[model samples]
Target: MELIVLDTAEAIASRAADAIEALLASKPNAILGTATGSSPLPLYDELTRRYEAGRISFAQVEGFMLDEYVGLPEGHPERYATFMERNLRSRVDMRPGSLHGPDALSEDLQAACDAYEAAMAAAGYCDLQILGIGADGHIGFNEPGGPLDSTTHIDELTEQTRRDNARFFDGDIDAVPTRCITQGLGTIMKARKLVLIATGENKAEAVAHLVEGEIDPRWPATVMQNHPDALVLVDPAAASLLRQRH
Candidate 1:
């Protein structure tokens, strides 16, 4: 694992954009694993700018969302698909077959998870995966005690997670879906590269626990420490807990 501390969130986002741009440049059909939420918003914005400027295009690129809220309506404003479509997909031009995600309302929820895993496997696995750290140190909704080798599957959001995500649903904790389908740590580890973006002081403890603490399911992100190619892009506020050599 490599730690990169940027001056601000904007800088971290720009660096992430640069990484994606380089990957796309090397392989137009690169499979990109995407994450939703505030951590990656700036990276998406930067990608939009590049797409508009013709510096980069998604025509041949493939996208796979990292997780989704199960039991939510197809068009639920809080669904990960809706979040991706509105925030990122709407801004780019991509082949119809390039974007894929787990269905929130599939008749067979387990089948949905299996299908998503199959789709990812068919896509040649992700060339690079973007990630966000939950306040409780979870990644892609793989809460504490989740199996490191598990594949895509249903997960029950913890109370801390529900409270953290309540802001998106107008502060209604009850509105937060109790279940989610997330890519497993083992699946994420398969990516050729992994980039985790985090900002703000709110994430400091989680970041520290993940980077400096033991590798345990208690803090899902800590598993990244064992990945061959994983990067943690953080701002000063988010890296405050680190004990710097200098």
Candidate 2:
């Protein structure tokens, strides 16, 4: 695990872009894992810039979304699928159907999760995964007390997660979905590399746990500490609670 403190969110995104650019340079057809939420917005913006500048092309890249909220309509503004399309796929050279996400709308959600997992397995999982640490340290939707070795599955959202995601729903917490289908911790660990972006003072404590704490289920993101190749990028505010600078 490697932790890097940048001056700002933009700087962190730029650095993350460097990594993606290098990976695509080596493997044009790489399977890529993507995350949603405000933490990764700047990184998506940077990627869009690089695409527009002809520095990177996603024509052959395969993208997998980390999670999706249940019960949202297909075009719901806050749906992870809609969010990724509006923020990324449409901004680059990627094909319309190349980016895949779990079927949150399926009546048989458990079956949907199984199919999603099988699809990822067929593709041999991701070469690189982009992530965001929740305020409560959840990754994807793997909430506290969940199994570390879980696969793709449905999960109940913690109240903290729902409150945190309320901003995307126009500050209406009740508008947020209570359940989600997320690639589990075990599934995420299958990626060859993991890159996590975090910022803001609100994320400080979570970042501290992810960087320095043990691999406990309570601080779910702490599982990254065991990944052979994981990079944590944060701004000063997010890194503020760390007792050891190095």
Candidate 3:
């Protein structure tokens, strides 16, 4: 595991983008695992800039989302698919057929989960996965106490997670979905490389726990400690609670 603390969010994005650029250069059709939320917005923006400037191209790349809220209407602006379209796919040249997310509205959700896992296996595991740590130390909706070695499955969102996402639903906590389908810790661990980004004071504790705490299921992000290549990028505010610096 490697920790990189940057003075500003832009620096963090730049460093992370450079890593992605190198990966794409090595393998044009690399599979990318992406996470939603504010933490990765800057990184996406940087990637967009690179694509527009002809420095990079996602035309041959394939992408996968970490999770999707259950029961969100197809066109809901807050749905994870829509979020990705607005923030990434629509802006880049990635093939429409190559990006995938778990079926959030499938009638047979268990089948959907199984199919999602199969789809990922067919595309080959993610070469590089971008992640964002929740304030409660969750990742990909895998909340506290979730199975450390679980696979693709449905998850009940914790009250804290719903509350944290309420802002996206116009501050209506009731509008946030209480359940979601997320790739499990075991699924995420299969990625060849992992890059986690965190910013702001709100994430300080979680960042600390991920970087310095014991490897326990209570803090899902801590499982990255067992990964062969994991990189954590954080702004000063997010790194405040860490006992040491890079």
lDDT of 2 by residue, 1-246 (tens): 999999988999999999999999999999999999998899999999999999999999999999999999999988999999999999999998999999999999999999999999999999999999899999999999998989999999989999999988889999999999999999999999999999999999999999988889999999888899999999999999999986
Cα displacement (angstroms), candidate 2, residue 134, comes to: 0.6
Off by over 4 Å in 1: none
Candidate 1, residues 1-246, lDDT tens digits: the string is 889998987889889999899999999989999999889999999999999999998998889999999878888887898888888887899766467888768889899999999999988889999999998899999999888888899899999999999999999999998998899888898899999998989899999988889988888999998899998999888889887711
lDDT per residue for candidate 3 within 1-246, as digits (tens), equals 999999988999999999999999999999999999988999999999999999999999999999999989997999999999989999999988678999989999999999999998888889999999999999999999989998999999999999999999999999999999999999999999999999999999999999999998889999999999999999889989888876
Model 3 weakest lDDT span, ten residues long: 95-104
Q: Candidate 1: worst 10 consecutive residues by lDDT?
A: 237-246
- Full ranking by TM-score: 2, 3, 1
TM-score of each: 0.97, 0.99, 0.99
**Which is better, 1 or 2, measured by lDDT?**
2
Residue 3 error, candidate 2, Å:
0.6
C-alpha lDDT values of all predictions: 0.90, 0.95, 0.94
After superposing candidate 2 on the true structure, give the runs of residues whose Cα lies further than 4 Å from its correct spot: none
State each model's C-alpha RMSD to the native. 1.2, 0.6, 0.7
| Strongest candidate by lDDT | 2
Misplaced by over 4 Å in model 3 are: none
